[model samples]
Target: MTSQRAPLEPLVPHPRAPVVPQASIIPPPPLPPPAPASGPAPPHVFGLEKSHLLKEALEKAGPVPSGREDVKRLLKLHKDRFRNDLQWILFCAELPSLIQEGPQCGLVALWMASTLLVPPDGVPLDRLLQVALERGYTAQGEMFSVADMGKLAQEVLGCHTELLCGGLGGPNRDYILQHIIAGHPLLVPYDEDFNHEPCQRRGHKAHWAVSAGVLLGVVAVPSLGYAEDPELAGLFHPVPSTPYQPPPLPEEGFSGAIYLLSKQGKSWHYQLWEYGQVQESNLQLTDFAPSRAMDGRAYVVPAGGVRSGLCGQALLLRQHDTSH
Candidate 1:
């Protein structure tokens, strides 16, 4: 089933991104590139390390986290993978990290991830919303079931999704990473309420995070700036604004850097931080609007790390392999 109603704004798909075959996704065509040297370089160019001076500066730098020191480790992992700084900049630009709208975090994350394939718009948000409403997966806007969400991918986007219960520790958690390392993007759920508890799978109070690639002891989950960016703000609506922007540097870009989405008294802020580290406290989910749909629901609990799901309940999604 396709969504007959269109979004308020037209989605501008990334260049070379192809549409999914199953859904009635009608993403607008990619726009032309800007003129060369027309403006200042992006923040990521300075987020990486391109010189010996930076390496020395990073080593002597204290861990107070001036935001620049945070850049050192991320650069070490991906700097060698790309040919030049410009190429790395382009690669980072293509990565998706849209902000969440209410309890639509799961939907926004899955929708954000759909852009990874060849198409401007991946799976339309309306299509996912429509299917969820029809199939009762929406669960009062909680978008509660990962299994049902996976089915949405199969039915609407023609993707192959797998559910893995990777425990929260060594070895067991490795199972989830194995797929990401194998190039599968993951949609994981973890309760903000149980973030500090190492052994609970309570589906109540959860949020979805998208992981694109993992390697070198770090995972790439691009996020932040979607709702804040002036150009993209219209599409990522109803989101509070943030003034948290990275301090400008030189040419190197931040490869593994992650923007932590947290809330202030009234608005949300994007702190320049890493999500790779295990949590010590709860994330503020008041903005997402709590729905107790996942309460008392049966969910998967995999063995190994003994505390898996620390990265949230892991759900892997990929395009169907049609090469038969």
Candidate 2:
């Protein structure tokens, strides 16, 4: 055994080896330096202070009555054929009384209520205007001049005509209406002749026109649909009826204007306005391709021959191509 045995190997250990004693291997305890004290969390911040103020102001304003009971009774009294016409008359008659409170309070409620009462396919524009004027002016306690009244008539009629003829949507319809309302001064001719120069006028005629244009554009664009056919017949399906659901209302209220312009065909183009400015692209549309980056302000671009953009004053869609 002594002759066969090799030289014994040296027992070398690591330089940083732990010196273990013959004892139980218990784990070390965790260090407790500090405890977190509980307190109230920080307040949430919103970017738009002015918008908050506006919302607060609107909330302070009370509700506007739509004479729903009267409308229901009227509907019951009339046949289905005459219901639409009668409803318009009733609505118009009530508008003045509704708005007598003031534009900020009364007008807002009246508009919202009216919108809710009438479905997209409800009443005709002619009847709607007739009722609106009768109610709206009566509340104001003033008679529009013949010229002004004619202008209003033309505005309403023209919008209807366009819808029938050109198939214009809400924005186009509203734009035409606003222009008529603003263009027509007193029922008779006014000595000031504000209609001669609409841009220079101090009144809200121009503002209303611009605002209307914006709103109409927002509602009109055939977005949010997946139909293969260009005709928007099967675009929007009816929402399922539910007891918990409230009536349909315009999702985006009249904020400000948004302007949008984008290419259409090889030479054609389309322009859209919403909120308070012009929208440069219908991002909602399938064919649209957005080129401009979105800043805090509205977006605009050249389309066809139009130099389209928002100039704060209004969303301008000027014809730049003089070739035609």
Candidate 3:
């Protein structure tokens, strides 16, 4: 038995030949970036979307000119004309500087709206700009379409707003009169210099001004003038020069289309109510003509009565909220 066991042991050197290496695990490839957006972008309500656009525009904008004194003077003039305490409500607590390096008529319009909605403390420029930027009201800092402004009035002010057309000749004067009679100030976009034609040589731009009062059958609009031209700042010496230093008068004659606004039964229309009730006077559009600021240039109004984006033709804004 011992010998058999020894023989069995000797047979086995069969062996430990080779060790195979294991393969390491590999991760899958990274995913590719998302594809670019397709098709036309959806329309956005100004001051409600793409607010960054507003910020960019404000950042690149020129410095605001000093126009407080001008506002004060204008307010006084308005008071003298209206002979009532309501004049204060019509004018901004202080004139705002919207025109810096470029034409910011839309900004001017916002400021005007602030003057009406927030009294004593008018719309702060910084606050307005911040809101506009946050809301995406500005269009690449180039221009704010009239349609966007109407949307702003509704969303920001929580009030009703509308837009009307002036057609090939110009805006309807009667339409403007109706709004003014209704006690709503108008944001009118027009040629800054009606005396001059639209030409490259003039270097002028389309401008926005506020019509807050009526002067002897003419619209009383206070404007920011040459705010971008610091060199011309002196022209407004003592008091800053407003686009309409003397206010647009009927005698001056109009040269461009004017946009208008108002509400049908707003509480603010007490004066209009009085005119209609006591004087029995009609708010006739015939009395108003193309303001001196209009030089037959294209103006904007909301198309189809929808108040959210830009559209074709000159128009008026009419708010019908009776609450004021």
CA displacement after TM-score superposition, residue 294 of candidate 1 (Å): 14
- Per-model root-mean-square deviation over C-alphas: 18.0, 32.0, 29.9
Better model by TM-score, 2 or 3?
3
Q: Which regions of candidate 3 deviate over 4 angstroms? A: 1-101, 139-141, 168-171, 194-204, 217-324
Name the best candidate (by lDDT).
1
Which structure is stronger by lDDT: 2 or 3? Answer: 3
Residue-level lDDT of model 1, residues 237-291, one tens digit each, is 1123543222221211343332222211111111222334322111221122123
lDDT of 1 at 69: 26
TM-score of 3: 0.37
Best by TM-score: 1
Candidate 1 deviant stretches above 4 angstroms? 1-94, 166-172, 193-204, 215-312, 322-324
Give the candidates in order of TM-score, highest first: 1, 3, 2
Per-candidate Cα lDDT values, in order, are 0.39, 0.22, 0.33
Per-residue CA lDDT of candidate 3, range 255-301, in tens? 21121221111011111111111111111111112331253322222
